[model samples]
Target: MNFHVTNHTLYVGKIETLGVASSSILQIGDTQCISLYSMFDTPPESVIVGPVAPLSPPEGAESAEGEDDRNGDAEPESSDV
Candidate 1:
């Protein structure tokens, strides 16, 4: 955003592109911070959500088509266990 300060008041904004910011600069109270901006060469392609690719399926390796995720065994715990 372009900040126009005439007596600490905004007057005009000349934004060309309209999209979410991957990064930004912020001033909060007495602290100042800057964010890193990044973008992909092309936006990701969309996928069809139909019976073939049903929504809310099990994630990760168990998500293969026609695979049975439940193997009649309790899930394994990580190091925290």
Candidate 2:
């Protein structure tokens, strides 16, 4: 099983249906879609049994933003100035 989130689109492969819900209780189509955040809160006991490659950020650690000045060891400004 593999799960991936790219460009705000989540892809879940190799799913197994535990049980079917009552159609009278709630309206459901042929396929069911669950939010990733909801699944993130609590995962199933024993589902998803497979190895998948780890995903990396689309952009590497190459930010154009300037570095923070406070990170340096420069001394603080004097009150005399």
Candidate 3:
């Protein structure tokens, strides 16, 4: 397994002779982790992990005040509402 450290957390992904192959995300609060595995019939290889940009809030969301004219971000926070 290989580890990639980001500004916020770490990530684990698969690597190959060509480069990184596939990756699955694992997160704990703001941290991240991933594990790499090899098949019994396959030979061991080096895996590279890289950083990724953090995601941003959805677009059209209100800054803070509730003044959405289009109601784009007016959805209820919970089903009880």
Candidate 4:
């Protein structure tokens, strides 16, 4: 197999998010040759369908109750000069 590419130009201003999933390719420039292969076998019985639970807080993170203090909800202490 033989391949050839010439005079390729690409311009981008902004990209918010870009995701490349399994067996996916994102090419931005010219290339001489490329090859890719992927295989997937999924059984219907092995898949689970259910409501997604809320994500748990990360380790060593402050609890929701403590977040209020940091968010400046409490009134500041008045000091008399």
TM-score of each: 0.21, 0.18, 0.16, 0.35
Q: Report clash pairs, candidate 3.
A: none
Best candidate (score: TM-score):
4
- All candidates: CA RMSD in angstroms? 12.5, 20.8, 21.3, 14.1
Q: Against the hidden true structure, what lDDT does model 2 obtain?
A: 0.47
TM-score of 4: 0.35
Model 3: per-residue lDDT, tens digit, 1-81? 998766755575963354544453333455445577655444353332456444345667456544354756766564434
Candidate order by TM-score, highest to lowest?
4, 1, 2, 3
Q: What are the per-residue Cα lDDT tens digits for candidate 1 across 7-73?
A: 5645556555555555654332344455487875654444454566535656673646653437845
Check candidate 4 and list the clashing pairs. none
Model 1 — TM-score against the truth? 0.21
Q: Predict model 3's lDDT versus the native.
A: 0.51
Q: Give the per-residue lDDT digits (tens) of candidate 4, residues 1-81.
A: 887756656778876657977677777666777777787778895565778654567776664443355667765574322
Worst lDDT run of 10 residues, candidate 1, spans 72-81
By lDDT, highest first, what's the ranking? 4, 1, 3, 2
- Tell how far residue 55 is off in model 4, in angstroms: 30
Residue 74 CA error for candidate 4 (Å)? 47
Better of 1 and 4 by lDDT: 4
